[model samples]
Target: MKTKFFSLLVACLIVTSVFSQANLNDYKYVIVPTKYDFLKESNQYQLNALTQFLFNKYGFETLMEGDEYPEDLVRNRCLALRSNVTKDAGLFKTKLLITLKGCNDQVVFTSQLGESREKEYNKAYTEAIRNAFKSFEAVNYKYEPKAKDVMVATENTEVKNEVAKEIKKLKEEIQALKEEKKAEVIEVEETVVEVVKKAPVVKVQTKEVKNTKEKVDMKASTSVLYAQEIENGFQLVDSSPKVIYKIKKTSMKDVFLVISKNGTLSKKGSDWILEYYENDVLKQEVLNIKF
Candidate 1:
């Protein structure tokens, strides 16, 4: 009789322990909130309660809310997330999401299966959540101070003075560091200017811009003068010294030569704009102007 009683007690303890270490994979989502703990706002029918309480009860770790599981309730399992979605211009709607199986690797479960008896499903799911929380707590996160508690040290005037002296020494050292930085900055600026002066100046030939009237209605009432360039074979030449243009109507028909103040023919040039429109009738000439 004694042996039988001992075996029975051991079996009960084992069952309790097994339930306490329940994982999310071994359960299904509750389709409805159980009316078991109504007065407690924290025990709402949402996933938060399911996750939080389970985390609290079972000490579950490595499970994040809204993650590692689908958060939306299934369509058949869906209760309106929004009490009145029309109110506040559609702002008060709770997003209907499904809670997926955790660590089970199967996220999709039939919503119809859960809807048949949501209360029972929720009861089992809640139990699993509670177990998960228990597992989380089994591995607690508590910190112990590495240093001795400050209160244990008796107050002393000499110790206070020593700390104050060290602080004053640190301030003096900081002030010295600042002075050194200021001197270094001045030295760097002088060195930069000296380097610039020592560098050789290489002058590059600048190119001129050519302005031509667009054939369509996008033509703006603006005139531009640019430099004319001449290239040796395929090499590019940019030598812009002046440019000028006017919006007034001219008598050149469809051909307008942009005459530069330096007398370069705008229409007959091997330049960027003139060369591109070799077969086109020149509508306007961009002249270059120099001060």
Candidate 2:
């Protein structure tokens, strides 16, 4: 009697897994939020970006929260699932889990708990997220939208065209804002130069900036570093998955303040260079960075 009961439990587990996989495969895309409720800032420690990256890596089509949605997804929200990462209280560990919900706000799937004991916030979050994603290894997800969604797509050609037009308009607006920001940066630089000329103390600071720029290496580094978005600006990481530098945005375009280091990170042509003072001499190292 005990053996028979064990067999029945195994059968039930298999059936539940199959059902969950079927529901997951019916959705074509997943949307990851720009920020998680447990975090104070958008993409803090690059957790949100890491979430999207892991989903795409695990055979799911993932989109950022504010990204333009496909026409069918816009028309029938049920065609996509919403993704969320939740934190669990732990005394000495960072614990997290991934949840996927349907259009009706019903939870469709939840990943196993992922925990990390790393003391650093960034490392802890990264490890916990990757651990949570391990649950998807067996899913083998491939979108097989239901027949009803396919039929709606076939019948909504006009609506698709309108969505396309709206997407185009959004792109134009984004470009305009970028250009406006560049203009403001240039104006700020001009004002700074005027102040330097009028004040003796300011003039000395201007010379320091000039010397830093002059020390920059024109040749770019052959090795590349990846830039991960953080709260203010970005953190550059090496291939070893180590943080090389954390930079904050400056008013000037393509220039960043290297935190804790008396230096600046700036773009020269297509290459990024780090200029810092070691002892009394200024040193420059060109960096190949991917954002």
- The count of backbone overlaps in candidate 2 is 0
Q: Which pairs of residues have clashing backbones in candidate 2?
A: none
Best by lDDT: 2
Task: Give candidate 1 regions above 4 Å deviation.
Answer: 15-47, 53-58, 62-225, 228-291
Point out the worst 10-residue segment of candidate 2 by lDDT. 196-205
- Stretches of candidate 2 off by over 4 Å are 1-6, 157-291
Encode model 1's per-residue lDDT on 1-291: one tens digit a residue.
999999999999666544433433233232223322322453444545454444334322322323333332231122111110000111322112223333334432211111111244345444434333333333333222112222322334457789999999999999999999999977865664464334221111011122343341112223433333332111112244232332211233222222322111223353212211223332223333221
Error of 1 at 266 (Å): 23
